[model samples]
Target: MSFADHTIRVRVPGTSANCGPGFDAIGLACTVYNDLELTLKKEAGVKITISGEGAANIPCDGRNIVWRSVQYLLRKAGLLDQYPGAVIHMENNVPLSRGLGSSATAIVAGLKAANVLIGNRFNRRELLQFATDIEGHPDNVAPAIFGGFTVSTVTRGDVECFSFLPKFRMKLIVAVPDFPLSTRKARAVLPAQVPMADAVNNISRASMLVAALCKGNEKFLRNVFDDALHQPYRAKLIPGMYDVFAAARKAGALGANLSGAGPCLIAYALERRHCEEAVGEAMKAAFRQHDVEAKILIMDLDTRGAHIVK
Candidate 1:
């Protein structure tokens, strides 16, 4: 096997899941991304190259998630024995274990690369199913594959995704703290059973959040963003969670919530200037109050989903 074989490159966007009340169901794609370049050869071997964030931590062998995703698809397509050799070059911009869907992006990129390498045997939906199967959830994977604001639900071993292009002007400000919280650890803190009141509260808020977004009712968001299901328990993990939320609100954000598990807060607003200023100031204040450093980023909703970048 040599490097000069059929090659394909894929760029997949990072995603923020949950989006306040829409726990484990809704997600939005952001501008952050991970790039994967895969080459296939006739021989039977696998090599992986990694760079950027988590390059030192992520495995550069068959154990990598990207490599596993490609192998999964190839095996499913009954072409596992056809190509014995592969070299995967991964450039990751999304942070790992930070709830930015870094793993999901890598999985999506690998599936896309495998599809191209195998002569496009599967379409986007099929690839999405493969990714979802590996990720065990469709929230992040759905938006990473379909883009924009995606509403996804998995039922009866099937994943359904619906996307809506945001008509109103908005900015997404993400505040990432210096500390990191593992999703597994965060999940462990949640109780196995919740009170009926908690369930009903989340349901109402989730519905209002969706309605506000679809109808572009910014005012509805102020109260609609409230979540009693996960945020209350998870907030204990992030020291600055409440302060960040308050800062975002005071700084002109329509609503703010924990991005994914914890440690990262997302503020939404219609004005770019307000979003930038408010997000920045809020992040700084929150970090200072918590005695932790932070980074603030402003990005718009990514309408274009996964596609070849040539």
Candidate 2:
């Protein structure tokens, strides 16, 4: 069997999941991106090159997450034997284990490349489900694939999701600490169950958070972020978590929360204030007061999601 050469490029955005009380259900896509270029050949081997964040820690061979995802999609589509060779070039700007959906980007990128090479056998919705299957959660994967703000749930092995553009103008100030906290460790610290009261609290708050965003009500947005579930337990591992959240709020942020798991806090600041840098510095100083150093990034909502380019 002979197949003509093909090249597919993909750009997937980084995501912040568990926004406030949404808890594995809601997510936001930011400007950070991980780019991949794949070229299919008639040969039967794979070559990958990765640079930028996670360059040292991420594998460049068969064990790489991107390659593994590519293989999974290709074999599932029954096209692996036909297109057995590929050259992959990746630029990973999202940091791993920092709660920035770096893994989500990789999975989405790989599946997209494989689907493109096979003549778009799977649509975006199917690809979103595939990415969510690989990630074990839809919050991050949904937004990484769909962009903007996404709320998703897993029901009977199916990923159901909806996404929308922000009704309000805002900027995100993400403060990343010097240390890394794996999602496994963060989840391990959480309890297997919560009280009924806590569950009810999160349910209401999560609903309001969505309404707040849709209605552009800053008051509800600010008040709706309180959670009684994961944040308190994970706080033990994240340095200056509460203090940093407070600092950002005092400096003109609408509200703040742990980006996804821990070690990075994303604050929603008003774009009109022009005080993002000051808020960032306050967050850094708060972490510094606790003997931890952190860096900051300012980004806007990425509404276009992931796409393929020539």
Candidate 3:
């Protein structure tokens, strides 16, 4: 069998999941990104090299998540036997384990790159399903694949994603703490169940949030981000988490929330307000009060999710 030797490069955006009260059902893609370049080889094994964020810790073997994802797609497409080797390079900009969906970037990149190599046999929806299967949820992966803001639900082993780009512009001010919080540790702290009243609170707020964001109704957005589901329980893990949110709001941010299973926190502000710097500074000062140092990134939404670079 003869095949063309070409490198498929994929760039995928970082994502923030569970925006406010939506839990694992909501996410948005940010401008930060990770790039993966996959070149099918005539050899028989995979070679991976990683640079930038988490490079020291991320594996370079077949155990690498990116390679595993590539293999997963190839196996599904019955091309594993035909293409037994690949050379993959990952250049990462998204911070690892910082609630910014870095892992999803890797997964989405690998899947998309492999699919392109196979002549794009799968569409975005099929790619979403494969990503969800690997991620165990669609929150991060949905937005990573489709960009913009995504609301996702998994039903009977199938994933459904509805994505939208906000009609209005806004600043996503992320305060990434120096320390990383593993998603596993954050989820372990959540209680098995919550009171019915708390459940109702989250439901109403989550619904309002989606509508407000979609409609670009800033008035409706204010005060709708309060969560009864996970934030309170996870608060203890992140010192001064509530204080940070309060400070951002006080500093002119419209709303704020824990970014995914987070030590990182995100705030929303109108882009035209030109108050992003102030919001970021307030969040930073608040974290400093808790003896934690954080890096601030004032990012905008990335509407182009994952795409080939070459």
Clashes of each: 4, 0, 0
Error of 3 at 2 (Å): 4.7
Better of 1 and 2 by lDDT: 2
Higher-TM-score candidate among 1 and 3? 3
Query: Model-by-model lDDT, in order?
Result: 0.83, 0.88, 0.93
Please give, for residues 1-310, the per-residue lDDT of candidate 3 as tens digits. 4343688889999999999999999999999999999988767988889999999999999789999998899899988888889999999999999999998999999999999988898999999999999999999999999999999999998999999988799899999999999999999999999999999998999999889888878899998889999999999999999999999999999999999999889999999999999999999999999999999999999999999885
Top candidate, metric lDDT? 3
Q: Clash pairs of candidate 1?
A: 43-84, 43-85, 44-84, 45-84
Query: What is the full ranking by TM-score, best candidate first?
Result: 3, 2, 1
CA displacement after TM-score superposition, residue 159 of candidate 2 (Å): 0.7
Estimated TM-score for each candidate: 0.95, 0.97, 0.98
- lDDT, candidate 2, at 69: 87
Cα lDDT of candidate 1 equals 0.83
- For model 3, the superposed segments whose C-alpha errors exceed 4 Å read 1-4
- In model 2, the runs with Cα more than 4 Å from the true position are 1-4
Model 1, 44-114: lDDT tens digits are 78888889988999988768898888889888888777766689998888888888888889889988888
Best by TM-score: 3
Write one digit per residue (lDDT tens) for candidate 2, span 82-104.
77778999998998899999989
Order of all candidates by lDDT, from best down to worst?
Answer: 3, 2, 1
